[model samples]
Target: MKSRDFTKTGPVAMVAHACVLVVVVCLLGAAVSHAATDEADSPLTVYVAVGVLDVDEISSADQRFTINYFAQFRWVDSRLAHDGPGTIRRDITDITAPRFLILNQQKVWSSLLNVVDITPEGEAVFRQRLWGDFSQPLRLHDFPFDKHTFELPMVSFGGLEQQVIMAPDPQRSSLIADNLSVADWRILGYQTEVREIPLTNDVSVQGFVFSFEAERIFTHYVVKYIIPLFLIVMMSWVVFWIDPTEAGSQLSVAVTATLTLIAYHIALAGKLPDIPYLTRMDLFLFCSTLLVFVALVEVVLTSRLARSDRVELARQYDFYSRMVFPAAYLAAAAWALL
Candidate 1:
């Protein structure tokens, strides 16, 4: 009877041990599956928001002028599925699809808009939210205000390979294709206007200002290329002061200067956007060219006078060119600035 009891207990113990092993294996399998799904669903992303105010037409009576602009974002459903092992791998692709909302506020002029008001308005335009995949970590910060903002994300991609798309305005008639990638992004360095348009009449005039902090490259171009070019052409008029016997040499110099200006224009053509209206750069080039042509004409007239022995008249030509050319150039610049 005792042997029968022992034999029954052994079978019962074995069965219990087998059941525990089965439960452990099932739990391990479920944990692995959950981790795999999480990995497949994670990805990184970037977003941008923009705002503009038109203040071109304002009356003196309207003292409370201001425009407020901001942006928010929503997740758009994407067809692409995220399937990757690393957190960076999964999130990097999502950076291509950015989403955001924009808010614009306009008010009558309360007082003259100062530089501080303008600075904040510009800063609000570039705030963005960035997120990482798998880890689901999020980062929120102000977008790089410098020209190099476009190139900052390239560090993650091994080499610079990023694209930029401009947000559109529903209310405006003009459609601007601001979309650009790495190759075209570099051209922004050549852009002169940080904020191209002010508040206009069709839209209520707002006192708010949006301006770009000029980059080093842009500053360098203005000081080194644009300013120096203008100065050189203006100085060419001094050639009129040289002896009329040297008039032929002066003419050659004027012609060569004009040609050099043309070459500069051609070199910059690819850097600028194709637009119907003239840019500030174009205006500068045009004025410089005109001055050079005027110098050429003055030289021709002086040469004729010298041949007739009217040396005094030839010298008078130099005096007028020195005074007239510079004054005219200053007037044109003032008008353009206004």
Candidate 2:
């Protein structure tokens, strides 16, 4: 086609110029609208704090504990701002806030209605109280001397990763040492953490954790289990000191001590969870039982020697056992502890 440029400044040129201006204005508006939408879609940062009010019960058999606690959330949203300059209260249902659930909660006994405090500047504080059982995995390889770190994990429910995020509120998170009434446990310390945890193959959520460290008191086991076990095992050793010629009486005493130890084991079974692996305490108990059985075996041997008319030899065996039994037991006990 030939170029037809007559330098024409007419109605057609003006109309073409107007259409171009409209197209440029429309493109600029779409860009501005897209930027605003992105700003609105960004996740809101919520500060999370957990305050443990009381520790009601800890069940080793069930691997769970009952707790009364309150969780606090604070965030700023300009949409919630009001005309009043002071703070005002509102029901949580009426306001927009993040919802969460305890990831390991087993049962809930009760929960108080949630409340939110809103400031004129759009800062909001939300508090909710819960009483329930939370599951905790326990490792008892040390048993009476074992220390544990218990955790309660909270994750955002029904919210996407681009919708919410969590931050630790150190100023508000706390553990009430005096209110922790778990029997035979001493509270060491506590802390809070903010993290992101994967929920599924293609999804993840914001997580908050409130954790506390505790150690078993151990005095109860020392008095009620270990000391008594030591005495029962010591009773079995008495057979070695008795006159070997009196085999009947020696057998009776040894049998009685063995029966008592068996009963003790039955009583302890009720207090601990049925686990597959052995613990330090279990090792000590096994050694004690073995020593008692060995003592019983010695009594039989000495009695056989006396019956064979070798009374002097029987007495010599008894003398050696008196020293050897105690030394062996002490070594085994040390090994279990170390």
**Each model's C-alpha lDDT?**
0.44, 0.83
What's model 1's lDDT at 193?
16
Off by over 4 Å in 1: 1-217
Write model 2 residue lDDT over 1-338, tens digit each, in one string.
Answer: 97867466688887998899999999999999887677468878788888888888877778887889888888887768999868998887676666778888988864766778999998989877888899988998888788888888887655333477778875675555475778878888888887766668998767888898878888999899888888988888888789999999889988888888888888888777999998878898899889988888888999999999998999999899989998998899888866
Report the number of the highest-lDDT candidate.
2
Q: Candidate 1, residues 160-184: lDDT per residue as tens digits? A: 1322223223332221123322121
Weakest ten-residue segment in model 1 by summed lDDT: 134-143
Question: How does residue 225 of candidate 1 score in lDDT?
Answer: 66
Q: State residue 201's C-alpha deviation in candidate 1, in Å.
A: 22
Flag clash pairs in model 2. none
Q: Estimate candidate 2's alpha-carbon lDDT, on a 0 to 1 scale.
A: 0.83
